[model samples]
Target: LKMGEFSNGLFGCFNNCTLCLITYIAPFGIYFVAKTREKIREQKGIDGGFGSDCLVHLFCPLCALVQDAQEIQPAAQAESMARE
Candidate 1:
């Protein structure tokens, strides 16, 4: 659970100015949401439908944003752990 705290939404938003700025701006938020959805759906093995994706970002942007940022690319993460 604690494995991804560093890159999680709040951490990213606080430490990375660009992530914070894009979170609140509509045009930019769209990009963030799309990227996040891709990352989660493709990298994290999640089944993310467009409607659910939009709902998450549109309704609870903070948590949604945090969740999106909360991991390494799945392959790299798995590989690193295997090496350890």
Candidate 2:
């Protein structure tokens, strides 16, 4: 959970700096989420499952990344408008 928050905060910093792209950030976020879940499963001796608690913790950051990506759409559209 803390890892997810850290990843999210990092993403937010990248977004604010305009240094990261969704194409890159999304997969990295997913990878971290998977790794966290794997660690939790190992620690708890549980088979892999949905793990709603973990997902709940991760959802907000993931949503924020998606929202940030969506924000680029209007900018792209404006660029296309100018090109025409």
Candidate 3:
């Protein structure tokens, strides 16, 4: 992935319906989205602030969550495999 670029589109949530459904149904889903966004920014060394993250989640929360999930899913899977 390149700097400031996501591997998936904003509305690509359907690509991973499980994640999308979880994010949509879970009460603590906002927290998960926030953390995921932080992880993505940190891993990619992208420039942004928590305030912006909050605003994004506060507004287009689902799309942001889906984007974050798509961005990190592969990395998380790879790390899980590495540990095993």
Cα RMSD to the true fold for all candidates? 12.0, 18.6, 15.0
Give stretches of model 3 more than 4 Å off. 1-32, 80-84
Give the best candidate by lDDT.
Answer: 3
Worst 10 residues of 1 by lDDT: 1-10
Give one digit per residue, the lDDT tens place, for model 2 in 53-78: 34533666576345434655677899
Model 2's C-alpha root-mean-square deviation from the true structure amounts to 18.6
TM-scores of the models, in the order given: 0.44, 0.29, 0.51
Distance from true position, residue 76, model 3, in Å?
2.7
Q: Which lDDT values do the candidates have, in the order given?
A: 0.69, 0.56, 0.79
Candidate 1, residues 1-84, lDDT tens digits: the string is 446454465455677777567666545656567666876687667886766777777778888777776654565688999999
For candidate 3, write residues 28-66 as lDDT tens digits: 655656666887898989888766776688789889878
Q: Name the runs in model 2 displaced over 4 angstroms.
A: 1-26, 49-84
lDDT of 3 at 52: 74
Is 2 or 3 the stronger prediction by lDDT?
3
RMSD of 3: 15.0
Candidate 1 overall lDDT versus native: 0.69
User: Which of the predicted structures, 1 or 2, would earn the higher TM-score when compared with the native?
Assistant: 1
